[model samples]
Target: PTSVSSRVYVTIAAALVAQLHAAVATLKPFVWQWDSNDGAPAWLENAVRPAPAGAHNTPIGLLRRDPRTLSILWEDGHRDDFDVRDLRLACHCALCVEEMSGRKLRDPQTVRADVSPRQIVSVGNYAIGFDWNDGHNSGIHSFNDLRAMGERAAAQSVENV
Candidate 1:
């Protein structure tokens, strides 16, 4: 009797899962498009609009708001504003971060509040390298990581509000 009841429960769960899958299959696919500046494709725009790979990581502009702030404008129209000190402290260079153990070698508390970049340079098309005012410049930050950080910061700000 117990075995029969367990089999019935399993059958009901499987039927419900099949129904859920069928419902999901009827839903449309989409991409969080920034804009169709590239012009719409021949296919139904939403149906064929594959998410632009690395679109957010492609920087179109970089601005220095002051000695303490940096702003990056991405190809997807997303802007990332980073405090210079914070960005400097987050460097992942071998000197700052132990390459073998993945331990943090640089203490954030030791980084001065006024720490900033003396220069920012494009490392090919995929990343940016910085010449920090404190003479630390080995770290190259990938645009993908930058975009992710910006997204997280934006979400956090919204949550805090």
Candidate 2:
């Protein structure tokens, strides 16, 4: 006697749990490297090498998300890549949710290279908050951010070229 809406919710809940399990299973510590796509130029990507560990005096280092693997790499050689799918489902941001207008930012790929985070601080167990270099840390983009950027690379490719 489950309503259609309830069934959908249950299915989504199960998927989210599975993704969380998968992300936890792959957690680790290591330095990460990523290959940029059209939106992000190769040179720009290379230029973004990890900063030194404890570089921020706040126990913070570079946070690089690999598009292919959704892995996170820190400058201090600590690495952990979460499930991109899950991260997208949990994108908690005013812009992403559009609480004011009841709209969602559909083009997560709009993230520009300039969106580089100036600093990163571990949030509660669920997320790592960011202070974007471009002052756009309001959106704590998870692995899904990387995929969106990669997918929109074609349109953003012009920036690279």
lDDT over C-alpha atoms for residue 87 of model 1: 75
Residues 34-133, candidate 1: write the lDDT tens digits: 1221221122222222226634465555556555666776655566898877777778889999999989998788888777666666666667777776
lDDT of 2 by residue, 1-161 (tens): 29999999999999998875433122223222223322221112222334443221111223344442344443233344444344443456885677878676646665453334344444432345545444455756543343344445445667789
Question: How much is the lDDT of residue 73 in candidate 2?
Answer: 40
Model 1 error, position 105 (Å): 0.9
Top-lDDT structure, candidate number: 1
Query: Which residue pairs does candidate 2 place in steric collision?
Result: 28-79, 29-78, 29-79, 30-77, 30-78, 30-79, 31-77, 71-81
| lDDT, each prediction | 0.64, 0.43
Query: TM-scores for all candidates?
Result: 0.64, 0.31
